[model samples]
Target: MVKKTDVLVIGAGPAGIISALTAKRYYPDKNILVMKDVKNGCIPCGIPYMFWSLKNPDDNKLGMDSLKKNNIDVILGKAVTVDRENKIVAASDGEEYKYEKLILAFGSNPIKPPIAGIDKAGIYPILKDMDYLKTVIGELKDAKNVLVLGGGFIGVEFADEFSKISGLNVYLAEILPRLLGNSFDEEFSVLAEEKLKEQGVQVLTNNKVTEFLGEKKVQGVRFDSGEEIKIDGAILGIGAVPNTDIASNAKLGIGKGKGIWVDEYMRTSDPDIFAVGDCAEKKDFYTRRRASVMLASTATAEARIAGANLYRLKVVRENKGTIAIYSTYVDGLVLGSAGLTEQSAKKEGFEIISSASETIDKHPGSLPGSNKIQVKLIFSKHSGILMGGQVVGGISAGEVINIIGMAIQQRVSMSELETLQMATHPYLTSAPTMYPIVIAAQNAAAKV
Candidate 1:
């Protein structure tokens, strides 16, 4: 049977859901159909918390209530091929879809490195599917010593959560010198490492795993230095790659980042089709060079842009580039970063000035729940424009880094930030007289 729809969206992750919802909001008269392979999907960001924070794994499920409430239709099937010449999509369910406009939000797949014995049992690669995660949870219940490969946010978070499972021995292995090395500066990475270590996580930095060791299953791992550790289970949190098999088979242009090539409006080579989320190519905000950043936040933003521009150029705001903003929490410590880091800026050949300020989040530093907040701002030395910033402190750091992101997007200058006006209350925010953001800007302005 062949189903017909004015707008067809593939994948039901954040990108797919948001794109469908936004399209409905813009073109209420258009019929939208979203085809998702998984009947029940889990929130991408909330997946890590399912290990411990969430009482039930179902708590992290991404329900279809939103699409249902909006009167959008959804189907359960995997799209096997796309006939762009006729605007038809064939799915594994033995059905065809005739789409007036198609949006691809197929998302990404976890990267499993090529190491001997890696395919052995007991090695779980993080996936967004709910049924697969349930299986992982069940298998992990019997694991005594757990090893997590890669020290990015996912690996670090998994290590932290696994450490709380009563008597589980969790080990985190990072080939880099520190955890989160690509996202944060050395100091911030060190802070995260310290917090993880405090939670009884055995962090092994500068360690390269040569191969997975086992007879029939993954029983241990041998490092390059010939050191081996026995582990009952292991998780591959290395990274993810764009899922572009369908797109490639359809003869779509792939970008340098190994994702579907799309223009500023998120339209692929075929004007009638669009791509968003991790499946689409991304460029650096400042450099305009190909970049690999797959975040739920970035995906949704692209979805909105693609949805609004599907039929016509309804939204003037085109995606300039990806800023790579990120935020993560460890124990009680929260870390947030936006744009480029100090190390990254230097490597990009930009003459920069960086400054940091430490202050309490609330007034007087004696407030009952006041916590210390540190802010770091990086600026183009010659231009004095905000380029990047990082924050560490209470939960408020999450929003604080967002404020800095806006500054970077707008190219706010150091002098302007130094005198920028903001709302403040005795209990809710830092004192106006010593705001860390303003202070950090002032310190940088002095050198600028």
Candidate 2:
């Protein structure tokens, strides 16, 4: 069957959904269609919580109500090939879609490293599909000892969630020296390790898994140092690679990071097509260098830009670059990082100054539900412009890092942050006199 649409979006993940909705908003008269392989999609970030926090995998399902409400057509099929010259997308089920404009949001796939016994029945890689995860969750209910490989956000979060199961021994192994090495400094990383330890999760750092050992199912893991840990199942959260096979097959320009190359306007080499989300290549906000950061927030932001400029160019709607901001909760602590870390900035050969301050989240230091909040801000030593920031604190830290993100995005200077005015309340925020962000900025200014 032949079908036609004004705008065709592939993949129904965050990027695809947002692109369809945003396109409807900008070009109300245009007919938009979204095609995805999976009927029920799981929230990418919430996948870890399905083991315990969420009642079931279905609890984290992404609904199609929004797509239906916007009058967007949703098709269930995997796109097999893209005929860019003719603006036709061929699906696996012998269906063809013709469009005037196309947006690719094919997302990504989990990185499955080749290791001995990796194909064991008890081993699972985190996937965004609901049905696959539901089966994994059912199997995990019987698993007493589960090993989680990799210490990034997904691995750490899964380890924490699995630990919540009664009598389940959760072990998290990271090849790096610390958890969250890519997003945070040692100080913040240490705090995360400490939190996970408090939850009774075995935190293993600077260790690499040599092999997954078992006959039919995973029974244990052998580390590089000749140490072995017994386990009933294993979850691989090492990382992900972009799903760009179709795009590559179409002869679209591929970026160094193996994602579809896109310009500031989110347009690919072919002006009629655009790419967003995990499938699209990203550049660093500071260096303009190709970056490998992928986040749903960044994806949606790119989608908005692509949707706005789908037909006519919207000069103000172009994407500047990815800032790589991230936030995660372990136990009861909230940790967030935005822009570059002090370690990363120094590694990039930028002379930087860092300042940190610790304060209670509420005034008088005695309010109910108050907790200690720690703030760290990084600035260029010569330019004194805000380069990055990290926060470790109570729930408020989640939003506090966003303020710092805004600072980094706007290139706000240290002096400006020092003199910045913010609203505060005794119960809702830190004391106005000793706000951590302002104090941290003041400290950095003094260093300058």
| C-alpha-based local distance difference test score of model 1 | 0.93
lDDT of 2 by residue, 235-275 (tens): 99999999999999999999999999999999999999999
List CA RMSD, all candidates. 0.9, 0.8
In the predicted model 2, the residue pairs found to clash are: none
| Tens-place lDDT digits, model 1, residues 327-385 | 99888788999999999999999999999999999997898888899999999999999
Runs in model 2 with CA error above 4 Å? none
Clashing pairs in 1: none
TM-score of 2: 0.99
Task: Estimate every model's Cα lDDT from 0 to 1.
Answer: 0.93, 0.93
For model 2, the local distance difference test gives: 0.93
